[model samples]
Target: MSAAAGAEAWGLAGLASNDPGDIHFDIVLRGYDREQVDERLRFLGDELATAEQALAAARERTAGLEEELASARGELERRVPDPDVGFGNRVEKILRLAEEEAAEIRQRAGTRPRRSSSRPGPRPSSSTPCAMMSSSGCVAPRTCSTSTSTRPGSPTDSRGGSPERRVAWSPRTGED
Candidate 1:
């Protein structure tokens, strides 16, 4: 051991090792043994030496922890941008730019003239006949059933109403 630690140990060794742990007392009707209380002095001798050693060890551990905490703080400083130099403002500027782009896109979408819908909308409800389901690839609505439109001649729905609602016009095969 170092000279200072050796000297401190030697000093503690010289003091009486008697402490509360070795002492005993009987539970009497009155109170504790007065002699035992006087002899141990409520954990004085060995406890003092042990407490000193524990305190010294704790101080060393605390010093190491303090050093580690300081090092972590230094590492954090290196990673983070300093608030003084536009850090918050830079983030706000980027968000503002994104918002402006979104607004411009919305305006462009709104300004463009919408084309009229040529796509067929939804079919009539199930109660009404849909022309497409007939065997001739869309017979007239009047002849909605596949069996009813089995008339084997025309390529088009001659009883045409709306073109989309009419029977599909394909080249009539010689067999038909």
Candidate 2:
């Protein structure tokens, strides 16, 4: 008898069973088991539909995540500063500040005239032109006047001091 005839006569008791393993097909005279093949096809059809749905959902989620990543990358690019313009501005500001400080230091340092610290010894008179000797120099006046004095050889201050005292310094000698 044919394989189909066997299934019909057997009444296929396990036809409604979920798994193909739950049913058995009878082989007859070197014929293909149509019943077994039909049961396997049914199982595969049901499983394929579920797998296809899950695959579609996964692909959709991946696409959404990729869009979010692209947006984040764009925001990061906007927030970062340009290297050339930003660093150039900072360097220019620093150089300008340094130049101003250098100018102030130059003004504070010079060979301008001031009071002598040692004894009121020989120095240039006020009429003589001042000259640069070393880091510091002074154009002395003929009067023995100083802000504060103690030694007899040095100039005296206004603390019961006498203005009549004079210092004889040579203006043309170029000596202090």
Per-candidate TM-score against the hidden true structure: 0.28, 0.41
Write one digit per residue (lDDT tens) for candidate 2, span 3-94: 33443565754443557577656676777578666754565566677789999999999999999999999999999988998999967766
Over 4 Å off, model 2:
1-25, 28-35, 102-176
After TM-score superposition, the amount by which residue 72's alpha carbon in candidate 2 deviates from its true location, in angstroms, is 1.6
RMSD of each: 18.8, 17.7
The local lDDT score (0 to 100) that residue 45 gets in candidate 1 is 41
Clashing pairs in 2: none
How far residue 18's Cα lies from its native spot in candidate 1, in Å, is 12
Off by over 4 Å in 1: 1-43, 84-176
* Shift in Å, residue 171, candidate 1: 54
Q: Write the per-residue lDDT of candidate 1 for residues 1-176, one digit (tens) a residue.
A: 53233324544221234453543465466797564444344346446677899999999999999999999999999998778666788677666655765587569659987332233342332222333222334322332211112122223334332323223333333453
